[model samples]
Target: MYFAKRNSEEPEIVIENTVVYACESASCNGWMRKDFASENYVCPMCGSQLIEEVRELPKIQTDFNSFK
Candidate 1:
């Protein structure tokens, strides 16, 4: 099997750290943090809860034809 190039440029990959925080209020909405190490970070408004940090997956873009 062989693969074909969809675009002249290769796909870009980026990794980032994020945090998932559950809303303290009844709302299910949550928040994220790019860097957990950062000492500064608070919900946009009150009533929101801070949960735990999580790893964010990098966004990948590719042509469907490549799989064929």
Candidate 2:
């Protein structure tokens, strides 16, 4: 049996500085993107207060045509 070689190259991931709201509670691991967050900065998981911070995250690709 012969095997064929496949492309081993992996796609490059783009990283960007994104603003987010993170939970202040030490035990809670909750966060949300600033763009999608509401006026209330309360953590939905633990009901703790949220604080603004910047983090390096992978770039998200959005297709506007999908909304229609």
The 0-to-1 C-alpha lDDT of every candidate, in the order given, reads 0.53, 0.90
Going through the candidates in the order shown, the clash numbers are: 1, 0
Q: What is model 2's C-alpha RMSD? A: 3.5
Alpha-carbon error at 38 in model 1, in Å? 6.3
The TM-score, computed over Cα atoms with residue i paired to residue i, of candidate 2 is 0.73
Best by TM-score: 2
- Candidate 1 regions off by >4 Å? 1-7, 15-28, 34-42, 59-68
Question: Tens-digit lDDT track for model 1 on 1-68?
Answer: 99986888886688755455544555545465443223444456664546565657664445842564
Assess every candidate by TM-score: 0.35, 0.73
For candidate 2, the per-residue lDDT at 32 reads 92
Worst 10 residues of 2 by lDDT: 59-68
**Most lDDT-accurate candidate:** 2
